[model samples]
Target: MCQLLGMNCNTPTDILFSFEGFHRRGGLTDHHADGWGIAFFEGRGCRLFLDDKPSADSPVAALVRAYPIQSENVIAHIRKATVGPVGLANTHPFIREMWGQYWIFAHNGDLKDYHPAPGQYFRPVGSTDSEAAFCAIMENLRQRWDAPPPLHELWEEVQSLTESIRAHGIFNFMLSNGEFLFAHCSTHLHYIVRKAPFTTAHLLDEDVTVDFANVTKPDDRVAVIATQPLTDNEHWTRIEPQQLILFKDGQPLYCS
Candidate 1:
């Protein structure tokens, strides 16, 4: 299985600090090193980077660590290659255009014998079950609505679609359309919301510490979701095994 990391903030924020620790899971701390990718959503567009190399050793990953790219919504993944071959196209954090919006998806689990019907509007370019499932969701959305629907309606549709997919196998995943982030827990997932009165935090996988209060404003709020906790000091809320949550403006709008 792979691993997922996502961030949704009320204001644009850089993920370099969190990713600095998360990327180590690619090969150093863990073994999900088949490939890796990330997407940062800015306004109506997205900045995507993918590499068929371990994030722990890839030069591209190092650049990402050094660059402070700010985004409102972000999704990242380190793949272990259960379904797709070890290649660029098989990297996680797959992206596609839907209703003129860029949607990013990343999965952390495997599907068994799952083959969905081809969609007319949305389809997968990569041969991964995660991408195929994403395409299926988009295709369903395209067929159901001509334009972007309300966030609540979209959440309902996504919840139903995730339930259907979960029937096949583990379906832990994170999705975003640059507006809101959706996370579903199949086995393992945790999150933490940081806001005013922030404190120093230390990474569990690395000897790194950051005092967020010194660097962030009083009104800044950020929600980070991951397959596992990234830090050792702060408390992370563990999501239930079968749950779907929608995060907007760095807060959980809905959970079911």
Candidate 2:
């Protein structure tokens, strides 16, 4: 299986700290080393990076760790390649254009016999079932509405589609369109929120800690979601199986 990481914040925030520990799982601290990719949403545009090499050793990943690119929403994945060949096109955190926005998606699980019907507008460029599922979701959304719906309505439709897909196998995933982040837990997922009066958080995979309060304003808020807890000190809430959550302004707006 792959691993997932996502960030949503009330203000633009860099993910260097969390990513430091998360990327270690790609080869150094764990075994999900087939490939890696990440996307950061800034306004209407998105910055995407991908590599078919282990994130722990890739120069691209090193650049990302060194650069503090701030974003309101971000998605990242480190793959173990359960379904597709190890290549650039098979990397997670795939991106697509829809409703005048670039949507990013990343999956952390495998699906069995999960070929979807032919899509009319969207299609997968990769061989992974994860990419197929992303395309299917886009196609379904396009067919269901002429334009993007309200956040709540969109969540309902997406939740229903994900439920239908989960019947085939695991479907843990994260999605974002610059404005909001939607996370679905088919098996394993966890999240943590940081706000005013923030305290120090120690990374579980690295020998480092950050006191967010010193770097953030009083009004800043941030939410981080991952396949597992990333910090050793802060409490991380586990997202239940089959649960879907929508996050905005660094807090969960809805859950089902």
* TM-score of each candidate structure, all chains considered together: 0.99, 0.99
In candidate 1, stretches whose alpha carbon ends up further than 4 angstroms from where it belongs are: none
Q: Report the C-alpha displacement of residue 144, candidate 2, in angstroms.
A: 1.1
Error of 2 at 166 (Å): 0.4
Screening candidate 2 with a backbone cut-off below 3 angstroms (N, C-alpha, C), the clashing residue pairs are none
- The window of 10 residues in a row where model 2 has the poorest summed lDDT is 144-153
lDDT of 1 at 19: 98
Worst 10 residues of 1 by lDDT: 89-98
lDDT of 2 by residue, 136-236 (tens): 99999999988889877899999999998999899899999999999999999999999988899999998999999788999999999999999999999
Every candidate's CA RMSD: 0.7, 0.7
lDDT string for model 1 (1-256, tens) is: 5889999999999998799889999998998779899999989989999999999999999999999998999999999999978998888788888888999999988889899988899878889999999999889988999999998999999999999999989999999999999999999999999999999999998899999999899999999999999999999999998899999999899999
Name the regions of candidate 2 deviating beyond 4 angstroms.
none
